[model samples]
Target: MSESLKNKTVRGVGWSFVDNIASSGVTFLVGLVLARLLTPAEYGIMAMIAIFIAVSNSIVDSGFSNALIRKVRVERVDYNTVFYFNLAVSVLLYVLLFLASPSISVFFKEPELVKVTRVIGSVLVINALAIIPRTVFVRDVNFKTQTKVSLISSVSSGAVGIVMALSGMGVWSLVGQQLSRQSLNSLFLWVYCKWKPSLEFSIESFRELFGFGSKLLLSGLLSTVYQNVYYIIIGRFYSSSLLGQYTRAEQFNMIFSSNLTSVVQRVSYPVLSSIQEDPKRLREAYRKVIKTTMLITFACMLGLAAVAKPLIVILIGEKWLPSVYFLQIICFSGMLYPLHAINLNILQVKGRSDLFLKLEVIKRIIAIAPILIGVFYGIEYMLWGSVFTAFISYFLNSHYSARLIDYPTMDQMKDILPTFFISSIVAFFMWCVSLFDISAYILLPMQLSLGILLAFIIYEKLRLPEYLEVRQLVCSLLHRKNKLDNKQIWTKN
Candidate 1:
């Protein structure tokens, strides 16, 4: 990699982490408050409509932002075309959702969904207005601006959600949160981003971009549908309260798993795309990314699982305790998400969205078995079944990576298994400590310290490269921060 690209990647990674951590942290704190203020069934109500919102959002993008990012020579008309296309699609979809809200309510046997759907469905259009700005920032690898946007949005919306929840708004507080967050996020992106679309729409640009993006659209649609299919099944076949428990588990798992994966995926995609032509550089970079991703993702996901019980009890109260088992199993499944995401990103970097779509089709087909398990057996079996599917999907996702970049499954596993092994040991130790008859306040801290201490010892002894890299990154960041602080103090004086 060139020195410039290396520096950009490093800076992008730092800001991306800050963006996700700060934004997700605020969102999480708000969720904790709302979870306490609300009932399980209330969360379930929001989860029930989450599928529609997710699918609509996916369709709104239709993978165009990715296409725009992947395109090396993006034109002004291209941005304008995609902006109009996305906004138009979002509007159409919202209308469809508005019309279909009644049926959605009927299917779930929850009459409240009709109004919630219309209100939250507006976010699709609101989000569309900011897609171009967000995409522009991402393509430029400008996550610093994004961090500012996300912090402001999350803080503002979280305050709104908390106030509403405290006002005893029930499930509507969740709806209010979603609306406020998206609206603020879109508004801030416009404020920070200077890109304004012109009145030009180019069919040539549309066709060119869509040629690459359409396959991703299909793949994204499949992925989105299946991802939320669990909510659909649980909402339809099971009770809303149970679905709420399931949603809580998934949310907790996502806080670490999805956010970490996203931070890596967002920055890695643009960086990897830039070097896609150089086979040797690409493969080496790919290896480092997979290892580093697993190193962090495995420890966090498994550690969260280890402290799942006490964490849930202390943070959201004891009523959410049922989510503990579901969270543990889901964390195992979530741990593999980075591997899955990175592999897919490789295909996109290679301009193999056709292959990407095929993989999604196959994986979603296989994913159906888990949905059946949830429908017939239970949610636990469903979550376990998901773990099995995640492993299978990893192999499937890696197939093209091995073919394209020579980083085969065995090689990848050999690289990541050490981290996984160490993480599992720490988790097991924490879980054992958690089983003791102790207060959650003490037990949570004890398990956390023990997990960290064990991981530090293992990594210090092994002298793993990924660990060393992370250590260096943390120290470098802190040193730079301290220097800036000192400089600011001197300037003031």
Candidate 2:
């Protein structure tokens, strides 16, 4: 990579890390408190509408944000056109959701969701208003501004949610929390992002962008629906309390899997897009990204699985113990999430949304087995099926990377398996520790600390390439910060 591109990648990774870490940390903490205060059925009611909201939000953007990001150059008219288009689509979807809310309640058998869906579905419009600005920031690889916006919104909305829960608002507390967070996020994005839409909308611009984006639209819809289909199945087939347990388990797994995937995907997509023309550079950059992403992902996911029992019981109380089994099973599947994401990102950055859509269609077709497993057998069997599908999807996604970048699936697995093996050993050791006859309060922290320390020691001893690279990256960042601090002091003197 060129020095300029490398610098942008480094800075983008730094701020994206800050954004996910701070924002997710606050959100996780607030959720723990809410879990303590609210019942599992309440969370299940909230979970029932997640798919609708996600699908609607996906339609609102209609893949235009990605199209804009991938384009070599964007015009003001393009932004205006996408903004107006998204706004109109969001309004239309909101109305449809509002009218369909009762049916959604009937499907879930949760009459409470009739009101909840209408209230929470409004985030589609609220989030649509911010899509263009957020996309612009992402295209520029400007995550520093995003870090500020996310942090403020996360902290502010968390405060409001906790207060509402304290006031005994029940499920409305979750409703209020979702509305406040998205509203604050949009407000802050507009405040920080100075771009405003013009009255002019260009059909030409829309056509140009949408031509590249339409396949992505279908691809995104397929992926979104299947991703949230578990929620749908659980809410429809299982009790609300059981679905609530699954939601909590899924959240724990997401803290590591989804957050890390988002950070890497957001930073890598724009960076890779900028260098898409240089196949050698793109391959090199992508290889590094996948390795580093998997290094963290494997360690976090397996480690979380190892500690799932004590962590859930301690954080949310014994009432949520059922979530422990769910979380452990889900973590096995979650470990592969970043690998799946990075492989697909190659197709996106290469402007092969046709292939991307094809992949999604194939994956969703295979996903039916898991859905059936849940419906027929049980939720645990469904999760085990998810683990099965995840590995299959990884192979399918990596097959394209071989054709596109000459990085074969086996080679990619070879690069990542060392870290996975090391992480598995560490996790096994931690699980052994958990077998001790001790209080969970003692066991949780001990397992966490020892697991981390052992992993570090083994990685250092093995001199693993990804581990050393991450260490060097951290050192370079610290060295850069110290120089800036010294420069400031020298100027003051």
**Clash counts for the predictions, in order:** 0, 0
User: Residue 345: error of model 2 in Å?
Assistant: 0.8
* lDDT for each residue of candidate 2 in 381-408, tens digit (9 for 90 to 100): 9999999999999999999867999899
Candidate 1 Cα deviation (angstroms), residue 380? 0.7
- Runs with alpha carbons beyond 4 Å of true place in candidate 1: none
Per-residue accuracy of model 1 over 392-450 as CA lDDT, tens digit each: 99999997779999989999999999999999999999999987999999999999999
| Candidate 2: residue 363 Cα off by (Å) | 0.6
- Candidate that scores best on TM-score: 1
Predictions in order: lDDT: 0.92, 0.92
* Candidate 1: 10-residue stretch with minimal lDDT: 472-481
